[model samples]
Target: MGNARTFILMAVMTALLMGLGAMAGGSQGAILALMVAGAGNIWAWWNSDKMVLRQQGAVELSRANAPDLFDLTAALAQRAGLPMPRLYLLETDQPNAFATGRDPQNAAVAVTRGLVAAMSRDELAGVIAHELAHIRHRDTLMMTVTATMAGAIAMLGNMMMFTGGRDNRGGALGGILAMILAPLAAGLVQMAISRAREYEADRLAAEITGQPQALASALARIAQMAGRTVNIPAEKNPASAAMFIINPLHALRMDALFSTHPPTEERINRLMAMRA
Candidate 1:
C-alpha cells in the first residue's frame, strides 16, 4: 500500500509538471518538462546519497574508528539479510539517523554524535534495524526521486513566473497560479509519501529486531532531545528533513502538509502495539 501510494503521488506530481509545461510553452514545453524531470530523477538516483552525506557533513566511519558501531550495524544487516551498508557519523548534538543509497548493495546509514551518546545498545540496535528496513524496502530511492521531482517542479514554477508566460497561452494569470500552486501541491504529495513509508519502516524495523519496545523508547527519547537540541545542518538543508528518523527542523509546525515524519507519540503507540 505504501509503495502504491508513493507511485500514485509521484505520477500525479509528474503529470502536474507536464501540465505546467504545456501551460507555459505548449506541447513542446510538455515534452521538455517530462524529459527534464526524467533526467533529474536519474541524476538524483545516482548522486543523492553522496549529496546528502556531504550536505549533512557526515564522515565515513570505519571499523577501526567505530568498531562497536560497525559490528552492530553488520549484525543487524545480517539479520535483515542485507549487505553491510557503509556507516557514517554526523557531528551534531541532535539525536537522529537516516539511510540513503540507490540500492541495498550501495546503501549507507548515518547517525548523529548525540544519537550514539544517548541510545543504549538495544536502542541503537533498534535504530540501526529501522534504517536497514528502509534499505530493504528501497525507500531511500523512492524518497530521493520524490524530493528531486518536487524540487524540479518548484524550479519550473520560478522559471514560468520570471519568463512572463511569453511562449505559451497560459498567460500571466495562469503563470501566477502555477507559480503559487505547483510547488505547494508537490510538497503535499512528498509529505504524504514520506509519512506512508515511515510507518512501514517502523513496522519492518520492529519485526527485524524483535525489539519494538526498544525502538519506541528510543523514539521517545530522540523526540524529547530533538526538541531542545539544534541540528544546524538539517536547518540549513530543510529539503533533507524527511530522510531523518525524526524531523530535525526546530521551528516548522508539523501539520499534515508540512510534517515528513508521523507524530512521535503515534509512532511509539504503533510500536508498542506491535510488542503487545
Candidate 2:
C-alpha cells in the first residue's frame, strides 16, 4: 500500500511540474520542465548520499575504528539479507539516524554522536534495523527522487516569477500564483511520500529486530532529546531534514506542509500494536 502511494504521489509531482511548465511557457515549457526534472533526478541519484554526508560533516567509520557500531550494523545486515553497508558517524549531540545510497549495494547509514550515547544495545539494534529496512525497500531512492522533483518545481516557479511568464497563457497572475504555490505543493507531495514510507519502514524494522518495543522506546527517547538539543548540520540544511529518523528541526511552524516524517506518537503506537 505504501509503495502504491509512493508511486501515485511521484506521478502527481511530475504532473504538477508539467502543469507549471505549461502555464509558464506553453508546450515548450512542459518539455523543458521534464528535461530539468530528469537531470535533477539523475544528479541526485548518483550524488545525494555524498552531498548529504558532506553537508552534515559525516566521517566514514570502519569496523576497526567503530568496533561496536560496525559489529551491530553487520549483524543487522545479515538478518536483513543485505550487504554490510558503510557506516558513518556525525559529530552532533542530536539523537538521530538516516540511511542513504541509490541501492542496497551502495547503501550507507549514519548515526549521530548523541544517538550512540542515548540508546541501549537493544534499542540501537532496532534503530539500525529501521535504517536497514529503508535500504532494503529502496525507500532511499524514492525519497531522493521526490526531493529532486520538488526542488525542480520550486526552481521552475522562481523562473516563472522572474520572467513574468511572458510566454504563458495566464501571464503575470499565473507567474505570481506559481511562485507562491509551487513550492508548497511540492512540499506537500514530498511530505506525503515520506510519511507513507516511514510507517512501512517502522513495521519492517520491528520484524527485522523482533523488537518493536525497543524501537518505540528509541523513537520516544530520540524525540525528547532532539527537542532539547540543537542539530547544527540539520538546521543548516533544512532540505535534508526529512532524511533523519526523527524531525530534527527546531522551528516546525509549517509542519503540515514541510514535515517529512509521520507523527512520532502514532508511529510508536503502531509499533506497540505490532508487538501485541
Candidate 3:
C-alpha cells in the first residue's frame, strides 16, 4: 500500500509539473518541464544520501569505534535478512537516527550521540530496527525521487521569477505568481508525502521489532527532545529535514503545508496500536 501510494503521489506530482509547464508555456513547455524534473530526480537518486549526511555532519564510524552500535545493527540486519548497512554517528545530543542510501545493500544508518546515551538497549534496538525497516522497504530511494520532483518545482518557480513573464503567457503577472507560490505548493506536496511515509515506516518498524511499545516510547522521547534541542545543520538545510527520525527543526512551525513528519502524537498512537 505504501509503495502504491508513492507511485500515485509521484504521478500526481508529475502531472502537476506538466500542468505548471503548460501554464508557463505550452506542450513544448510541458516536455521541457518533464525533462528537467526527470534529470533532477536522477541526480537526487544518486546524491541525496550523501548530501543529507553531509548536512547533518555525520561521520562514518568503524565497528571498533562503535562496537555495540555496530553489533546491534548487525544483529537486526541478520534478523531482517538484510545486508549489514554502514554506520554513522552524529555529534548532536538530540536523540535521533535516520537511514539513507538507495537500497539495502548500499544503505547507511546514522545515530546521534544523544540517542546512544538516551535509549536503553531495547529502545535503541527498536529505533535502529525502524531505520533498517526503512532501508528494507527502500524508503530512501522513494524519498529521493519525491525530493527530485519537489526540487524541480522549486527550480521552475525560480525560472518564473527571472523571465519577467515574457516567455510564458502569464506574462509579468503570471510569472510573479508562479515565482511567489509554486515552490510553497511544491513544499506542501513534499511534506504530505513525507508524513505518509513516516506512518508507513512506523508500521513496518513495529513488524520488524515485534515491540511496538518500544518504538512508541522512543518516538515520544525523540519528539520531546526535538522541540527543545536544535539540530543546527537541519535548520540550515530544511530540505533535508525529512531524513531524520524526527523533523529536527527547532522552530517546528514551518507551516503545516511544509511539515515533513506527521504530528508526533498521531505517530505514537499508531505505533501503540500495534501493541494492542
Best prediction by lDDT = 1
RMSD (CA, Å), each prediction:
2.0, 2.0, 2.3
Error at 183, model 3, angstroms:
2.9
Q: Tell me the spans in candidate 2 whose CA falls farther than 4 Å from its real position.
A: 1-9, 167-173
Q: Give the alpha carbon lDDT tens digit for every residue of 1-276 in model 3.
A: 557756776777787787678776778878988887777767877887888788789999888988888998899899888999989999888889999888887899999998999998888988898888888878887776776776677677667766644354677777778766776776667776778778887887788778999989998998887788887777787666777888787653546546778988999999888899
lDDT of each: 0.88, 0.87, 0.80
- On the 0 to 100 scale, the lDDT of residue 90 in model 1 is 98
lDDT by residue (tens digit), candidate 2, 130-149: 99999999888777677677
Clashing pairs in 3: 165-171
Q: How much lDDT does candidate 2 score?
A: 0.87
Task: Say which prediction, candidate 1 or candidate 3, comes out ahead on lDDT.
Answer: 1
- Which portions of model 3 show Cα errors greater than 4 Å? 1-3, 252-254
- The true-versus-predicted C-alpha distance at residue 174 of model 1, in Å, is 3.7
List of clashing residue pairs for candidate 1: none
Give the Cα error of residue 65 in candidate 3, in Å.
Answer: 0.9
Whole-model lDDT, candidate 1? 0.88
